[model samples]
Target: MIVAPYMLKAFLCSVGLTWMRSRSPGAGISRSWARALPCKPSPAGVAAVVGTAAVPPCCFLQQGQLSLRGGLRVPPCAFSTLGWWMVGIPPDTAGTSSVGLRAERSPVFACSPMDLSELLKEGTKESHDRAENTQFVKDFLKGRIKKELFKLATVALYFTYSALEEEMDHNKDNPLFAPLYFPVELHRREALAKDLKYFYGEDWKEKIQCSEATQQYVDRIHHVGQHEPELLVAHAYTRYMGDLSGGQVLKKVAQRALKLPSTEEGIQFYVFDNISNAQQFKQLYRARMNALDLDKNTKERIVEEANKAFRFNMQVFDELDKVGRSLGEEAQDGGVPVHDGKGDIRKCPYYADKLGTAGPSCPFHAAVGLARQPLVQLVLAACMAVAAGAAAWYIL
Candidate 1:
């Protein structure tokens, strides 16, 4: 029963986390927070509904609740600063969500490097000062990694540290860019202003719409998408490049995820042969962009759109948070559907009689089918591309 000092510290920390979550008394909502690229003004009632909130990742640990869709509770934990990526799974109801109290503690089994985040936290001001120092940045990168051998260590550092100067200070990559110069201040919603009328039947404030500047950001992004095609292809490449074979790395990720990585990852599903001459294919992609002849302003516009994708995503979560919170409150009242947990798969014939369900045109099924089409086509196209490349290689 006698605990050591360190053990005592940890025990108290866990106790402390529980205490923090339970702080807001009166029937805790089963809320799930999301980890995202960076902060954005949430859609009104996000945090209030589930009583769950998503905070940006920091170097030190964080304490909060995160919910996957459909209610899988994510206990807070120490995670990497996405450097700016949202850890975002866009707003799809298909993902899981959970609600409960949990510690923002690091897992024991994960083989992680020393608390580099903690180290960086201590040096945040200093590192930002040296934001332009390539040598210091390289040293910082080398110091933060773990590898079995030096050669492999170099490779990890090579990939991880590729972008430094720009990330630290450039407007394009900095997490704080959206807050500055957009005219409106950073959105920090009040706890109760969440009950908007649409999601909650209460008389809500006129929805605080995205500011005009934000709209400009959105318009610029879409405009670029149509006029400058590189962003689309670049985004596609960025989306598909990982775990090409569903190799060991994915298998590892799959293990940690209660749902294992499985074969669904990477380009294994990709029919494209590994590009031996990546330059040539890149040249082809570049040619496509060049042919577009998108003006420089237009090209930048597309990149801006790429940026808005993230901003818009957070906006949705913000709104969903309101809806989700209201629903959680409703569930607390009487929203739990009493079935064998089997949904009325079809609309309740009763509500349907009154409001006419989209019946045969169950939009959900249609959307699901439509979503799968592009993916199937992409795979087949990649396969065809791979086969043609192989054939050409053999002919040569």
Candidate 2:
């Protein structure tokens, strides 16, 4: 029995995708997926925001309206049908796959990690571990004496960190000022005071100052290190899109599992609009992942590790998710007025979000609105004084 090959394997095994070590003789690892969901144009970039009635609409849902044009309904996954395939790195035994989109692997909450593959394969590290407990971290420490597992473990942990980092990076520079996706940006304007406080525990800003790697990532992407928490929140918003977006299917599923109403709105803040023809692209993505160069063992290890990463993510979320309930937010009605219970008028914004923050149409952010106008007045005053000085000198 192979106990473990790598620490990532152990972590992955702890979470479940460990069955990937063997190759089915006839099956190709590269499989086709559905299609890519259309990503809306970045608000500051080239992404096209779908109008309420845009015919060639790329993103299905827009503003506050779902696309009735294409009968845009939620599939098994709120992501486009091909979402799984797009995220799939290696195709499963099936010719077509729901690899990434669907929750294929079961989540495990383990305190300790172990890789059973090594025990069976090379059987090299049979010395230290004796009574590896299946439940807690202490038990796992008590069980194995595998020397090689530690090296593999480092890789697993590093890989997990990288994935988490990437997840955050993708959002930080998204060019879309839609904090409705991650509502805390309102707090970020005054981020120096509240950012580290609300998100990080304490002295968090100083902690970022020490991270050269973080600074490097930010510099590479044209952002500052302080932006990391923003990215983290952004990534978190994307990953737990169900909580953020009003994914009724996800809500129903979660509601049934956890015993709550799926329609419990004002609970999340995310935005992943349904893209068209999402089913066919996933297979294409699976091909892309498998195409990456690696030997069989390493490949399998990556797959297992990726799944393990998901589990690790779940653990992180387990700790952080509780904070979701305490979130102070609400769904916007695309900038329309609302009536209070007593029938008083409530103000809504057009491009400004729930935070009274602005985007595309915000006057507060405009140079002409926020600074340039005043700056021009000051410059004019200075220029007039200078002209008067010159005239007085000439007359004298």
Best by TM-score: 2
Provide the RMSD of all predictions against the true structure, rounded to 1 decimal.
Answer: 29.1, 30.3
Q: What's each prediction's TM-score?
A: 0.20, 0.22
Error of 2 at 53 (Å): 38
Give the TM-score comparing model 2 with the true structure, all chains together. Answer: 0.22
In model 2, what is the error at residue 5, expressed in angstroms?
A: 66
lDDT of 2 at 32: 20
lDDT (10s digit) by residue, model 1, range 1-396: 232344445545544554554432211221111232222332333231111233232222333344322253333232332211112121222231121112122211111123222222232323222331233222212221111121122222222212211121233222212111111111112211221222223443342344333344345434434444334422222122221221122223222222213443211212223332222222222222222323455445444443343333234323333333343221111111111211221111100111122122245654555544534445444555555555556655
Off by over 4 Å in 2: 1-248, 251-271, 320-396
Report the alpha-carbon TM-score of model 1 versus the true structure. 0.20
Residue by residue across 122-223, what tens digits does model 2's lDDT show?
221111121111122221112211222222222222333344444444543342222222222111122222322333356644433313333333342233
What's the true lDDT of residue 350 in model 2? 7
Query: For all candidates, what are the clash counts?
Result: 32, 46
Best by lDDT: 1
> In candidate 1, which residue ranges exceed 4 Å CA deviation?
1-252, 259-292, 313-396
